[model samples]
Target: MENTSCCIYTFSPYIFLNAYGGLHGGAVAAVAEMVSIACARTVVSKDKDLFLGELSMSYLFAAPRNAEVIVDASVVRSGRNVTAVTVEFRLGESGGVVYTAKATFYNMPVASL
Candidate 1:
């Protein structure tokens, strides 16, 4: 997939504080998960699918609510049954990295939902 396809989300104060004065971890995780899936989709074709077996991230810096953020993901390794992906969350203007994640996707056969 084209790198330009990566999604960019603007950080807003509402998205940061929900009846609270701090950023929500779930929001961060959600962005990471979306990037992971997007990266996996770019690698596997229609005949195949990927299951997110494991995902991990380290939030190095607090994401500011005043700047634009971009999520970029790429495949690290692809195997017969597994694919490893890496995702980076960066500031759109400064190009500073705020978070990094790694995930492994599993390709398997199971009962179709």
Candidate 2:
């Protein structure tokens, strides 16, 4: 199957900020995971379900509150049972990357649901 890609614009709220007043690492990771799963689902068959296997993220810069960040996610590898995806968080349109993440998902057959 062809690779799947998606983009979204998000705002870092103060509630998701860290002690340094930047976006919390956990929040960023959550976004990466959510996007990766969405990308995986697009490449997999309708009867298959994708679950998070492994995930890793590298925070290169801080995302300040109220700043509009762009999130781009794409599938890198789509295998029979395992799929890999990458996600990037940017400052804005055509801006530098603030965070990067790589994730692997395991596909399972969906039955009775």
Q: Compute the lDDT for candidate 1.
A: 0.71
lDDT of 2 by residue, 89-112 (tens): 998755989999999999898778
Deviation in angstroms for 66 in model 1? Answer: 2.8
Clashes of each: 0, 0
lDDT tens per residue, model 1, 5-50: 3444555443654344444567777878877787677766657767
Per-model CA lDDT versus the true structure: 0.71, 0.84
Q: What is the C-alpha RMSD of each candidate to the true structure, in Å?
A: 3.8, 2.4
N/CA/C clash count, model 2: 0
Mark the regions of model 1 whose C-alpha exceeds 4 Å error after superposition: 1-14, 18-23, 110-113
Output the worst ten-in-a-row residue range by lDDT, candidate 2: 5-14
Task: Write down the RMSD of candidate 2 (Cα, Å).
Answer: 2.4
Task: List the candidates' TM-scores in order.
Answer: 0.76, 0.86
